[model samples]
Target: MKNKFIYLIYVILSNLPDFYMIRVWFRNITKLRAKVLKLLPNMEISNGVKIYRGVKISRNSNLILSKGVVIKEFCILGGTIAVGEDTQILSYTKIDGSGKVTIGRDTHIGRENDIFSHYHNISDKNILVNKSKECFQEIHIGNNVMLYSRVAVMGGVNIHDNSAIAYGSIVTKNCEQNFIYAGVPAKKIGERI
Candidate 1:
């Protein structure tokens, strides 16, 4: 009952236009918001964590937002996830963390990006893909990564440190460290020096 009430408060606070406007004028409102978020069950929010208005976090989510993490407006985060310090998730991004998803520090994720940790089982040709059992896979993103706008990271992908993903890329495999990837299936285009 306590958890439900807290979640209700969070939902109400997140939707309030006045609260959102006040946050723009008073930066301290971000801290206040973090305090409220910390009250939710299975949530660990550190100092300087900013969760902007219109961001939806599922009730069952086990989330950890490190210090200086900024989640922009209209972002959807669910399941078990941990974001390192100073990571920024831009507007309209969706992180479906049905499995564990860990993002290292100093990472920048551009707007409208989708990071998914779950997929439907497709081994059975007799059954529809949508109707198949869901499979969960962990996604690990190393430090100082940059993901451009509209990128789609599929399940079981490991993006190494200092990597940059170009816009509109679909990541279906592992990304090596210090590399730039782009394309429909996200191939290595260049290496970071």
Candidate 2:
């Protein structure tokens, strides 16, 4: 019951115009919002966490946001997720954590990135992909990783620490540590210096 009320208040506040004048009047709006969000069930948000306006977090989600984590405007987060300290998820990024998503510290997920931890099982040719049973796989993104704009990460992918994925890449396999990857079904391009 308390979570519902908090979520309602969040919904109302998130709809308010994010103009300078409005912010001036509500100087601590972001902080207030974070406080309310922190009260939700199964959510653990540390200090210095900034969740911008227009970000939609599902009520069913189990989220753990560490210190200095910033989720930019219009991002959608759902399911079970744990984001480490100092990580930033840029605008319009969608993290589907139905199968669990663990993003490490100092990571940057660029704009419009789509990270999913669940995929439809399409082994049966008779059934349509959409109608197929869903398979859950955890996505583990190590510390100091960077996923550029428009990157699409499929389920069961482990992005090792200190790696950088180029813009518009589609990652379907595990990425090595300290490497640079690019292209569809992303392949290693070079080592990160």
Candidate 3:
């Protein structure tokens, strides 16, 4: 379609001489970026969604960004990932949705966070780690959740609404609602008011 052609033009122009200059030009042009975002299949992006430069979105994936969602620079969103309204994913965050990742409304995910919806099977000691098949599971982050910097969310974890995860935490289990979780293999530290 016309949008694809425009995106192609943008890609070609961005790869030309003075790459940084062209990236800056594209960064300043929100409309141009939005137009490209609209071309993604199964994307239900609402109004006021801001996807900054250096963000990588997979071509063959379902990405839904609700109203007022902001994905900052260098964020990689792959596979099936749905971000709810008013959610902000800061810079350097990588969301792997090889299974499915559903982030609820009003959520704030800080920088350098790694969220994975799939994991490799390491049950068999005989099998090579790299050759093992990946196990897929859904990761759900409920409404009003706040995940601080450097948090790692593994697969099959359900983080309920109104929860805040502290920095440098590794979430391997379900998080209770309306509480603050911290430390490795994150535990409920205290209740959130």
lDDT of 2 by residue, 1-193 (tens): 8878899998887766556577564446655667788988688999988777888999889999999998888999999999999999999999999999999999999999999999888999999887999999999999999999999999999999999999999999999999999999899999988
Q: Which should have the higher lDDT, number 1 or number 3?
A: 1
Model 1 lowest lDDT segment of ten: 16-25
Name the better of 2 and 3 by TM-score. Answer: 2
lDDT of each: 0.91, 0.91, 0.85
Stretches off by above 4 angstroms in model 2 are: 20-27
**Candidate 3 residue 174 C-alpha distance from true site, Å:** 0.4
lDDT of 3 by residue, 1-193 (tens): 8646755654543333333457676454543554567765566678787766667776666888888888877788889999999999998999999999999999999999999999999899999999998999999999999999999999999999999999999999999999999999899999987
The weakest ten consecutive residues by lDDT in model 2 span 23-32
Residue 68 local lDDT, model 2: 91
From the highest TM-score down, the ranking of the candidates is 2, 1, 3
**Cα misplacement distance, residue 132 of candidate 2 (Å):** 0.9
